[model samples]
Target: MAFDVDHVLAEATTEELAALVCGSGSWHTTGIPRLGVPPLRLADGPHGLRVTEQLLTQAVPATCFPTAAGLGSSWNPALLKRVGEALAHEAIALGVDVVLGPGLNIKRSPLCGRNFEYFSEDPLLSGTLSAALVYGLQSNGVGGCLKHFAVNNQETDRMRVDAVVAERTLREIYLAGFQRAVTAAAPWMVMCSYNRVNGTLASQNSWLLTDVLRGDWDYSGVVVSDWGAVYDRIAALIAGLDLEMPQAQGRAEAVAAAVEAGELSREVLEVAAERLLALTDKAASAVRPAGKIGHHDLARQAALESMVLLRNDGVLPLAPQAKVALIGAFAATPRYQGSGSSKVNPRELDRLLDTLSARCDVTYAPGFRLSGELDDDLIDEALLAAEDAEVIVACLGLPDAEEAEGFDRTHMRIPENQRALVASLSEAGKPVVVVLSNGAAVEVADWVEETSALLEAWLGGEAGALALAQVLTGEAEPSGRLTETLGLRLEDYPSALMFPGESGQVMYGEGVLVGYRGFDALEREVAFPFGFGLGYTTFRYDSLTLTDTGSVVTRDLRVAVSVTLTNTGERAGAEVVQVYVRNAPASVSRPVRELRGYTKVWLEPGETRTVIVGLGIDAFAFWSTPHERFVVESGVYAIEAGPHSRDLPLSGGLRLDVPRLPSALHDESTIAEWFADTEAMEALQARAVARTGERFALSEQMYTVVAGQPLRRFAMFPGGVLTAEDVDAVLAEYGRSV
Candidate 1:
């Protein structure tokens, strides 16, 4: 029988409603079978699906694609959408309703263990890519869940740590990506984080889940708790979290008891039950096709685009017949995916050593163990292989123990023994190429200069090795850019001091300045800037022109931009034309430049293409604390177009003439605020002139003294120029305008 969500919601009793809002087991939502509501099954995803009915760790075979770090670096939203569609097809085959990911948390710190699952440090990039993925997933039958809703960055004390952040910072940085994805994709579900935001737990933070998510962003999706994230079930439900996962024991009875006692409204319970039933209906209605996917080929293609060629002294795209020495244990057993619940059991996994051997004259050696322990025999064998080979390809990365979902990394350096091997290989008089396999950015400043080439093949899944082989042999190009900056040291990061705070509270001291924004603001030197990648070919950017497409009367503030891109190098390649915006003097401090929009264009040698990117009003707006919303202060904004953040050759400016928003005045508003508002200042001067037949006047020095004081407080002074009644009338009149 086709499930009628309306009928089921009407018939469900209070007890059944309570049960319906909680999960039945680990991966299934609670369903009132008596009311004809079927359970919706969910599985862990973002990279790929982990569908398991028994142990969560042991899952059926699914094609694991490149992780978000890999996908984000690709800077191709269209590719992400295709990947999402492939995931949806696989999810249907595995009997899962929703795939719980495309984790959009900003990569605040390199030490964050779950950085693999997230897209980028920049909210615009993460949000844009995630939205594409969501659109693709839902376009097919399967549903995608946008997860760890907000500020769930680090893994250290994830379930209990308090993330203390300012409202502006939250709106601009941490929560911005989720906001973008929610508004753009409208995913079927949004999973609340485990940790507390500010002082309140995320599960019960009404401001985060209700006021901001639903009220402001208009997210009309079911809010589910991260597995075992709920502490107070009644509070979580009341705060707009509709469902509790992993079957919270006794919570359903407690909810019913609360409703019976009038402590929790029965209407809220009914609303929650209605949302669950609607979700079940939506899941059941999706018509999934029979499994017909060449996921392995897609994984290979994605992995190829995800490989970032960090640096090249012209040694890459090695001669196909060249003798290559394949060093490091990772060449044989690649760490292609991240650890923990998001891990996938690949239907087929490729090894770089095998792929290289099949293509060229390659010798293999275990330079170092994955355990990071020193072994003299392995080092000697690797050096011997390098001695006879024309080129040395050393595969190195963080071991599984170093980075996972449970804890944060202590440092950004790769294994000590691996660093030792790189040093040894450099002395062999052969061109050394370093192939990295970590999920997050690692410290390469110390040893990167020793190698002729560096390839940041971040946690490419399943067919990653085959992709690496292709890039090495010139069959494919390394087109991925750095989503996060690779700083010289871990301490260089803005969140280094406060990340995973000591006493259960982590302060977001740096505010909105994160990733390249922080680096650019401080003029800090980094190993690699964001949106930086070198392919087998080079490209030139010319003639950047921006046309104001929006009207000032309507306050649209949209700009249509076009940049001419030509492939200067011999080989065909794709370049990600990044468009960054810089606001002309504002009241608040902001990043020097923020990524507003970007587009990837493919070009052949001497082929020119005009790439168009549009900037909306949000590009020029900043979250104003006093106004309590995103406002674009009237000014000229500098628009820059380039390949990366640091290398912009084309620049233009757009003057926005939108009216400044009236100050939100109140009794507590400072005297300076009143004077700053032209209308408010004119009204005060008119009243003073009516009484004394002269304009209101105060000495510059005297105004400075009283500028910080509240406007109403001036009336309290003995023999003050203003009376209490006069002050009240001004406030009453001006407050209405605001």
Candidate 2:
């Protein structure tokens, strides 16, 4: 039978819930079994799925993917999609229901260590890629959940610090990605973050959970709390966050008790129950109809696709059967993921040396440290191991403390011991492949300059080890791209000062300028710019077209873009063609260019094809003020489309031949976007969006009625989109003289 949440909840009682809550009958239910499902489920997530009884570690070994920051850097959506599919297959084999992943939090600051788990510094890429992952996972009939919903960008003080972004910026940058994922993928479940968004905690944000997720996006799935994230179950239920995970605290009967005390409404209770039952309904459905999947090979393939090659000299593809020196304790003891709520006790963990040894004569040296550096003795031993080896592969990077969630990292340097080991090994004049297993961006200048190759095997889970093995053995081509910039130094960013000095408040004086915006604003160069990553194969670019000029500045401007790509290698691979827009001249300082559109393509050896993407006119405009609105300023815009930001292959310019938006439209969006377009509401919004940041927020009235619709044509659709004739009809209805 199809699971009916409403019906299931109607049959549920406080007694039944209590019996299950205190560990009675496993909360088991009898329903028609789905086709593809296992008899019982063991789940994985926040990172990936899990199986067996042990909470952190389990029976089925899951190949862990790289952290969000590392995957984000790859900027390869196609690879992410493949990774998602592979995860789904693994989950099914493990009898897992959902793979809780593709963490979609914003990168509020660079101090965040888990940026590797997310994608893009911008919302568009993050949301777009997340949706792709969710879609691919569900393709296997195993649901994947989009996670850490709302402002959970930072890790240090993450559990307590409130992300107080302005309403407009919040909507455009932070929440936009989550909203997109919800609308596009409709993941089986959404896991709320542990932090507060706007003043109320995410677990209890009514507008966020109800008005936005369920109301706007109409998300029909269940909402799970980040482990230990639930504070008040009744309030969280009233606010519409359902299903506290790792099991609920003392509040399993809180809803019934609230109904008895008249503190919570029966309506709210039913709504929560329905949502919970709805989750079971979908899982039940997946059990009915199944899909075909190849779990083992998919795991290895995903890891291969997700691995990013930061730098490589002529020494890659280590001669198929080369005897290799795999140094570093990390080779044996891998840190697949950071510790905290998202951490899982995997059923199986694959170590790099273990996986690599199967393919060739791979010897190891215990050379990793509490830091990602080396000691003289360990280095000498590693160097000695490489004595007769054809290539030297050293696995070095951060440990749990360096990338943990409790505190911000004081420095972004490799540990002294690991540094000594790597630098010393580099002196041997042998091909040294340095594999970095970290989550955030690190200063690898020294290592890059000295090493023969660099591979970022970010906490690639169960499959991470074999993925690295394939890249070494030439079985698969490296296709991962970079998501964030790897600055030569941390201070290169404008948010540097505001970063380290966090005492209950951090000012976003940089405003809309973040990631590439900061780099473009000061004309400062980055070691690697945003939207950057190198592929083993090569591609070409040509053909740019800009179509449709708009009369109103804020109105849509359509521009078509095209590029020619050839498989400049013996092997076939994929590439992400990025389109960035440079504002010719603006009222205010703008970033060099913002990412507008991107497409991924695959090519066989010597094959060629052209790709064209459309650019919206609004992509050229930025917010000047709530009252002044967004003025195109009637200028030129430079369109650069290619593999990466700094690596633009084609460039062209187009004049804005448009008129400024009528003051009403700009003001309407500004006021509607932020509660502070006028000077009158500025102070109120500052306190709400900044002071208490997440706690205090703009009143709904301020978000809406401040400025009426531009011309009320919003209600119009198809032929009804108010032509002058429609306006005349409206005037007739009002009986007013026009």
Candidate 3:
């Protein structure tokens, strides 16, 4: 007889129902064998499948794709979708039901140890890319778990730190990506974060899990707690968490006790059990047999597209016969991916030296160890190799120990020994091509100018070395761009002062100004701007046009922007066209420009194509504290078309006249705010001038003081002429006008 999940859930005792809500065995959820419900097996990570019955040892071999940081730089949703499909195939091969990632956490800080597993600093970019990954995985009969929900950006004190963020910042910056992913992809599961959000554990936060996620976003999926994230199982369940991972350690008894004591209602338990049964049904149907094809070639292709060519000076695409000196241990023993739970045990790992040697005459030396003592003899050997070579390619990056899960990096500089190696190699008079292999941004200002070319290969996976070889030899074009800004110094970042907070609290003091948005807002200089990359060829953007230039009036308003782009250079390559929107002066302060939309296009030499990007009202709206929602203020919005945030060559404008219902006048309202009501101001101005004479004049300085002061407070000022009755009459008139 076929097992019926619903029938079992409906008849199961309270103890059995509680057990089903928690994990049964390691990495597997409890299932009723009599009812035919099988356990849902989850495995490690966003980049690849790292599955093992044991938590700490002996992971099964799988295809290792580029980390999220590297893939994020690609900005190609289609490529990410293909990677997701490949991951789904591997998950099935490993007998895993849910692939536990496509981690959608925002890259709030460059020093965030787990940034390698996240997408970008921008929420829209992170959400759109992650949604594509989620869609691809689910379409391939594998369930994708969108994870580390809400403000789980840093690894420091990750399990307990309270991320204290403002309401507007939380909505616009921190939670925006997860919101986008939930609404767009509809992943089967959402894993609650280990950290505390505003002093409440995410697992037990009803507002985050139930009100915002289920009620506001209409998410019908099961909510699973991050392993060990559940504190009070009953509280978590009540908060809309349907599952506890890594097995039940007395949590089932606790849930049963709570339900028996009448503290937790039986209805809630029944609902939770129903959701779990639904998830089990979904998982059972999604299971498929593994395929025979290996994704090594696809991994290489992904790596090739993910590499951001930070700087190039005619030394790249070397002559076929140019003898090369390959320095640094990373070239021989590559740190292809990040450490921690996301680490993949690849079927095979490639080395840069081996890949390069297969194509050209190459001399190799371990210029520096990633950690501890550096060998002077090895440095001398590397110098000797560089002395004889026509060009030098040095692979240098942060070691696995420098940045990884469970801790945040203290600084953003490259390891000292690697820095020394680069300095010596660059001083050797041979053109140096520096290849970086870290997961996050490192300061290159110290030695970047000396290098002839720079390639940011961020923890590329098993085939990263081969991809690097191809790009170095001009077999492929460097199409990836920087997803986060490469700052000149750590102090230049907006969150530098309060990052990785202390005393169990991390404050998001920077608000919505994160990454390039922060840098642009503060006008800080950075080593490389976000969305900046150099390809083998050049492209020119011209003939900018806005299809809808009239006033926008509705929430569903959209403006179509078209720009003609041409490959001006000789080489065939790809270019990412970025579109940004700047709202004319509004009630709230905003970034000078925010990225609204972007699309990547491939072109032959001298090819021209017109790309049309659509912009909706959300692109022009801000999270309004007064309105308690996203609102578009009636104003002119400037449309900027560019290769990156800082380099806009084409521009257009749109006038939007969104209708907004004015709030009722109150004592707490500012004088300027009251004056916004023209009829009310007209009635009060004449009465006030008559009482105070020249003292009540609206001069620039006088406006500065009184414009922000509350109307009630101004009425009580020493020389004030306005009274409570006077303000009430004006408000009454304002209310009448409405």
Please name the candidate that would achieve the greatest lDDT relative to the true structure.
1
State the lDDT of candidate 1 residue by residue for 192-288, as single tens digits.
9999999999999999999999999998889999998999998898899999988868988999899999999999998888887887888888777
TM-score of each: 0.96, 0.78, 0.95
The candidate 1 region of ten consecutive residues with least summed lDDT is 719-728
Residue pairs in collision within model 3 = none
Error in Å for residue 648 of model 3: 0.9
Model 3 vs. true fold: TM: 0.95
Clashes of each: 1, 51, 0
Off by over 4 Å in 3: 1-6, 287-293, 549-552, 664-667, 677-702, 716-738
Rate residue 610 of model 2 by lDDT. 79
What lDDT would each prediction earn against the true structure?
Answer: 0.89, 0.67, 0.87
RMSD of each: 2.0, 10.4, 2.8
